[model samples]
Target: MAIPQLKDKQVLITGAASGIGRAAALAFARQGAHIIASDLRLEPLQSLQQEVQALGVNCLLQAVDVSDEAAMAAFAAWVHEQVGAPDVLFNNAGIAYLGKFLDSGLEQWQRVLNVNLMGVVHGCYHFIPLMLAAGGPRQVVNVSSTASYAPSPSMASYAASKFAVAGFCDVLRMELAGTRIGVTDVCPGVINTAITASGAAPSMQGEQLQRLQAYYRKEGCLPEVVANDVVQAVITGKTLVLTGPYSRLLYHLKRLSRRLLFKITLGTAAKVGYL
Candidate 1:
């Protein structure tokens, strides 16, 4: 398929308050696309709206909790009323959990699964039907993580959620193959974002936490880089996109030897004080 032109297209992005979502909203807006940016926080969404509109393109900001089925449904309705349907839907809202699965509890699992996994499910369930009805050609981008392939020992729930996202996108992509809508599973490695800081549990305050944060800061790629890649992938109708070099490497490593990869990942997590 030929690359789709984004000019004047409607793009919907969740978790647009920060990180890759924020970067994507700006990137698409710069390409002359109308942006519907949604996030959990109103203040940040408002700030994002200003930045997006500054690009001289239309931007609609909504405070949405993507984990809520009812809220997502309402958001879909609102989008239908305001912009009809998005030419591109980016289901990017997610949370991170950074601790051993044993140290975590049921609440952590529920929260992580709800936001990181079910959030994508809700977005697709509510938005795809609308997109199909409004579409000639459109796209859906589901944000997974490098953890989808190479999960750190300390981040069990997070890894599980991302794995589910990747699997779900795989199925969705096959189902939508004959249609004009394309599904992309985006697996991003560490990107400089507040997710780590926000996910830091109360019990995790100390030198170990600082070290982990430093590692991400020193090695993580910029969110804008991922955003640019996502835009290009959408134009080319890519089915899977690994954002950072590390993410791509991890994917290949796991494929080569799952057992050896697991040991290596566990060892590295322990050395980094993540386990």
Candidate 2:
């Protein structure tokens, strides 16, 4: 069923050039929402704008890097000026880093956290005021990862950033409890996207990276599955959504037995040479 609230609504999404963000932009556009899409790349955003406009909805495209606070602030101002406050703000821009803590340097950790954690922060810091001013029913969706709860030794930076995002969402939700704005924490498991290939994994060889990418392509779920969950979450005011294959199972297992979850994850990581 189409959501009545989404029709003709203003929805702002970062990282909309590809992967989950791209899927989400299309999903929202299909519901007749006006899309405000951004990414660090321009070409893909243009292509996405064409697709979104073809869906018979308006799309405003921009090349904005979420990690850059000043740029994000300008973008937020532009959004407010262009279409007033957005009914939904999807802070979905993120990157991945895969390596043991000792193997990765400070630069790698900083880069990961800057994009994955601070990007979400920048979005909320700049856009929340606009939503507050508009003051009806609004949604803030933050894209976290299953790694937030189900930690892995090989993905130290990625896990840390996601854990921070999850924590931030929890606090933000509590703070906004009395308001009409709803916060959603979206945790996705493996999904077939270019992130696996584009992520930084310094220790892995070329052949190993290729194998890992192939594994994700074969075993991961589609990005649209997560996008559908995002739409449902907004409609129902869901606080937490675990999407994609093994996402729910992993969350449950982590809650059931952290030690067991670690044992299983560590064993699997070893098998895949991620250790």
Candidate 3:
């Protein structure tokens, strides 16, 4: 069911060129929401804009790196000038790092955290004030990962970044308690997306990367599945959304017993040859 309130609303989404962001853009467009899409790549953003415009909703495209605080601030200023405060802000830009803690370098960790954790911070810092000043109902969606709850062996940096994102959203939610604004932390399990292909895994060889991508393609859910959940989260003001296969189960398992969940995660990763 479409949310009637979403019609003519403005939505800003980062990492909108592909994967979950692209799917979410189309999903929101289907709901009659205009899109403000940003990505580091202009060509894909243009392609996404074309498809979004075909959905009969306007799409404004920008090439901005979410990891850059100054760039995000400038983009936020531009957005305010163009459409005031957006009704929805989706901080969905992130990168993946797949390597054991000892194998990964400090630079790799920094890069991952810059994009995954600090990116969310920049988005909330620059945009939330706009939403508050506008003084109406609004939603902020931060894309964390199931890794936040169920950590895997070779994804130390990725898990750390997502954990931070989840924690940040929790506190942000509390701080915005009395306002009309709502914060939702979206935790997605493996989904068939380019993230695996684009991720930095220094210890993995080309063949291993190919195998990982194949595994995701064969076992992961579609990005549209998560996209639908994101829209629903916004409509219902859900505080947390766990989507994709095993995401909710793992979340519950972690809550039930952290030690058992850790064991299960290690066994699963080994069985899949990810460790």
Candidate 4:
């Protein structure tokens, strides 16, 4: 797929207040994308707007919780009214939950699913149609994680949520192929985002956290790095993307050695004193 030129492209990003979202917002702005940056955190979104404006790209801020379909719908409507539908939508707001499957309460599980999976779903429901109607240079980028395929036993909920996002992106891409819209699913490995600090609960335990711990060092790729990868993916018509070598390795192993993966997961868990 040829890389799409981004000069003056209209882009909207959820979770743009910080971490990968904020980083990508800045990168896109520098490359000349008019940005609509949103987050639940008002101050950080304001900060993001300032930085993006400094890059000489138009930037707007909104305080939005992506899980709220009504809020997302209204947001889409506002963007249409104010600046027109976005050429690119980054459905990037997400959460991390690592806990035993049986132990996970409905509330906790639902919350994780809401943000990580339904957030993407809601964004598409409201935004994609408008992008189709508005037309041209339109794309959607969904940030998934390696855990979607390399499902960690303890982080079952988070893994499930991401899997849904990946699944949706894959199907949605095909569905929109004849239209003016494109979709990219990003499976980033351990990005140095506050997601570990803010999204994952301290109580997460078991074999899953062990595997994640093995992969996530304090020195993972910076949020900025994943952000750059995202922009590249959006520009290209890349359907599936892994942000790092580890993510690619994990995704392949899961495809090639699913049963062995089961045994190795338990064995590795036992070695780590997690099983």
Candidate 5:
């Protein structure tokens, strides 16, 4: 199929203040897409708005906590009043937790799950109906992670939330079959982002946290790489997108041999002190 044109389109992106969300905002702006960038931080959101406007495209910044259902509903209502339905909705707001399940408390799980999973839920619950009602070519891209399929030992909360996101996207995709809207699950592996620096759980501290941050700085792919793939997925209507080599490899390994993949993952988890 011919790639869908993005010029003059409206794109809604969550967590647009930084990381993959920031990269995607700039990328879509370059394509002449009007950006609706939402995030929890007002200052960063303002900075992003300026950058997007510098690209000569319209950008509207909404400061919102994505985990709050009522707040998302309000945001969605505001969008309808100001911009009508978005042509593309990118559910990219998420948080990370970096400890074993046993070490973590209910509050940690609730916090991570609220942001990583319920945030996506709120975005979809509010925006998807509008997309369908508008009756045009629309796209929903839910940002998951390689951990959705490639399970690690200590990051149970993070993995579980991503897994839920992937599964939700799959079911939504099937439900939207034969419609103008397409649902895509975007799985990004290690990407160089401030998420590890700022969003890591308290349980990861001192040497372990430093080591984890160092590894990502040395080896993680750029967020722009994932942003580009996300754009492609929307244009080409991809159902599942794996952004990095490791993500693809691990996904295939899981498909080929679940048992072997589990054993290998366990060994790596041990070496990384994730056990």
Candidate 6:
């Protein structure tokens, strides 16, 4: 299929300071989109602004936390007041930590839900209406994960959050059925980023990084790959968007062999000492 075009459009990306968000910001900028890059990390957001601006596209940097609904509303309003309503909103801000459900503290669980689940909720509540008002060429890109397919022992809380996001995005897509707005869940397996380095926030990749390094790392992917996929999905309005081959395989297995895959997953986890 011919790739859909996204030139000269306004795009907003949360979690744009690092990892997939940064890559998405840069990628969209390369496509001639006006970029609004946001993250809790102001310094990195500023750096990304500089870098993308050097690419000769407009970039607005905002240090907004997606978990906060009030702040998200304010951020959207600011975008309207400044960069204009985004043709695309990458609701990509989230965090993860490793802990079984029982072992996870209430604080950790709430934090995870706030960012991973409620963050998406807040973004949708705030942005989708604007996209509807704008009437066309609008997209909402949510960063989910393959873990959303089922329960992950070590990533119980994190998986729960993603599951919520995936389901929520699905409903959002349905509700926007006749509208020009669309939703795409960006589910990626693994990508090489600082998700493992020191001081990494308790987000989706934080806890899994150590285990991947020990046993699961397999040729990993680049964030740019997901960024490219996001652009394609926005243009094509694909319901499900995954980054790598392994991710697609896992997705297929989830649909084709739920019981068998669950058993094998447990068996392999036990073998690898992850269970």
Best by lDDT: 3
Q: Model 1 — TM-score against the truth?
A: 0.96
Report how far off residue 56 is in candidate 6 (Å): 0.9
The TM-scores of all predictions, comma-separated, are 0.96, 0.96, 0.96, 0.89, 0.96, 0.90
What residue runs in model 5 are displaced by over 4 Å at the alpha carbon? 1-3, 198-203
lDDT of 6 by residue, 4-39 (tens): 677888889888888889999988888888898888
RMSD of 5: 1.6
lDDT of 2 by residue, 178-214 (tens): 8888899999998998886556557775766666677
Least lDDT summed over 10 consecutive residues: which range in candidate 1? Answer: 197-206
Question: Which residue runs of candidate 2 sit more than 4 Å off their true CA positions?
Answer: 1-4
Can you write out model 3's per-residue Cα lDDT over 1-275, one digit (the tens) per residue? 12337989999999999899999999999999999999997889988888889989999988999999999999999999999998999999998877667876788888999999999999999999999999768999999999888867778888899999999999999999988899999999989998986565567757666666787898899999999999988988898999998899999998899999978888877766477
Global CA lDDT of candidate 2, please? 0.88
Q: Count the backbone clashes (under 3 Å) in each candidate.
A: 0, 0, 0, 1, 0, 5
Per-residue CA lDDT of candidate 1, range 1-275, in tens? Answer: 12379999999999999999999999998888989999987888887888888998999988899999999999999999998988899999998888766666768889999999999999999999998987658999999989888878778888899999999999998898888888989999889888887575555668878888887888888999999989999888888898875898888888899988888887888776586
* CA lDDT, every model vs. true structure: 0.88, 0.88, 0.89, 0.80, 0.87, 0.78
Which prediction has more favorable TM-score, 4 or 5? Answer: 5
Q: Cα deviation in Å at residue 91, candidate 2?
A: 0.4
Which scores better on TM-score, 3 or 5? Answer: 3
Pairwise lDDT winner, candidates 4 and 6: 4
The segments of candidate 4 whose C-alpha lies over 4 angstroms from its true place after superposition are: 1-3, 199-219, 263-275
lDDT, model 2, position 155: 80
lDDT of 3 at 210: 69
Q: Candidate 2: deviation at residue 73, Å?
A: 0.7
What TM-score number comes out for model 3?
0.96
Candidate 4: the clashing residue pairs are: 4-235
TM-score of 6: 0.90
How far residue 106's Cα lies from its native spot in candidate 6, in Å, is 2.2
> Alpha carbon lDDT of residue 149, candidate 1?
84
lDDT of 5 at 1: 14
